[model samples]
Target: MYIPQLSNQKAFDSFILIDGVLHFFQFTIGSKHAINRGLVGVGEKYGFPKDMAKWHFTFVMPPNRVLKVPQAHQGPLKDSKLYSAILDVGVEIPVE
Candidate 1:
């Protein structure tokens, strides 16, 4: 998805699922309104929604693999820059 794939982006970051579950992800920014919003979810922790029209979500899918996103990670994808971030479960934060 890209900015042009929508009627308009006036209020918040708008995005569409290009690949529900695939090896790659993508998104296109539409209106600035949406881009400014970033990611959104039930809580404020999931990365603020971005206006990227397409966002690529990828994980190594294995046979009989039931991916369970950590409670914190369920919110938003980590910055791609942290492609190899180590997960430290010893530190826990109480959620509201």
Candidate 2:
């Protein structure tokens, strides 16, 4: 399942559920604050478990761009045990 950005306060760029895990994705040019706040808000709104083991957060940006996580949000993000990933734009697919 996949959902696009919501019009609420806890709006996220994308939401996906694979198997039983909830994955929230944010695509940003350089706003670290938005990424930090959005993820936290979504978890709170959904009443996710404290460990957040089933939750995944992905930060997507253009190729060659680097996103830096804010220091203040580092601990919470890490402690939640959230899975994180990155996807670059304009990658070619191989024919198999």
Candidate 3:
């Protein structure tokens, strides 16, 4: 899986899967104050609640066959950028 990353970014650097939706957090200078606030749970590791609106992409359930997101703790979709990216990847539907 070739996930896009910024300069020297790791797999789980600036992103988190909250409730099955993968969110990309693009932090800016103005966001410094908000980032300072305490982030609770796994969502904080990626800087949520503040940068929640800056999410880059969102894929609906069944993100693709190659990757499986455990359906455990999920939240509401706040915002999104490109749906085309999700379609271009061709996610596989799981078998029931």
Candidate 4:
């Protein structure tokens, strides 16, 4: 299901129920550039049921940088620490 461009102009993706668990995958929605707040907004609007334990949500992390740099310029684009952590561990861990 999807929410129209209501007052917020943000789009909600889908909600699926499997094995009694409500799963929601949401993308950009609010000022936070994440879905955490968006989930809460929709939840309140829907008057979600009491099966809190059966609810699951995954939010997308927004990109932090976008720029045009010279070809010779090369001074630590993004954060090396974050890149290192991802390599050390794995993508399974949420970067956000």
Please report the candidate that would top TM-score against the real structure. Answer: 2
Give stretches of model 2 more than 4 Å off: 5-11, 31-50, 71-78, 81-96
Candidate 2 lDDT by residue in tens digits, 1-96: 556545443445777766767777766566353445456666677665545556666766655555665433455555433333556566653322
- Model 1 vs. true fold: TM: 0.21
lDDT score, residue 44, model 1?
A: 46
Which order, best to worst by TM-score? 2, 4, 3, 1
- Which runs of model 4 end up more than 4 angstroms from their true locations? 1-11, 29-49, 62-96
Q: 88, model 3: CA deviation in Å?
A: 7.9
lDDT by residue (tens digit), candidate 3, 46-76? 4455444444442233333233322213343
Worst 10 residues of 3 by lDDT: 28-37
Residue-wise C-alpha lDDT for candidate 1, range 1-96, written one tens digit per residue: 324355554322233344431112222221111112243342146432353223333332223223333222323443321111123345443332
TM-score of each: 0.21, 0.54, 0.25, 0.35
Select the stronger candidate by lDDT from 1 and 4: 4
Poorly placed runs, candidate 1 (over 4 Å): 1-50, 70-96
Question: In candidate 3, which residue pairs clash?
Answer: 19-74, 64-91, 64-92, 65-91, 65-92
TM-score of 2: 0.54
lDDT of 4 by residue, 71-92 (tens): 2123321211111001122224
Per-model tally of clashing residue pairs: 20, 0, 5, 0
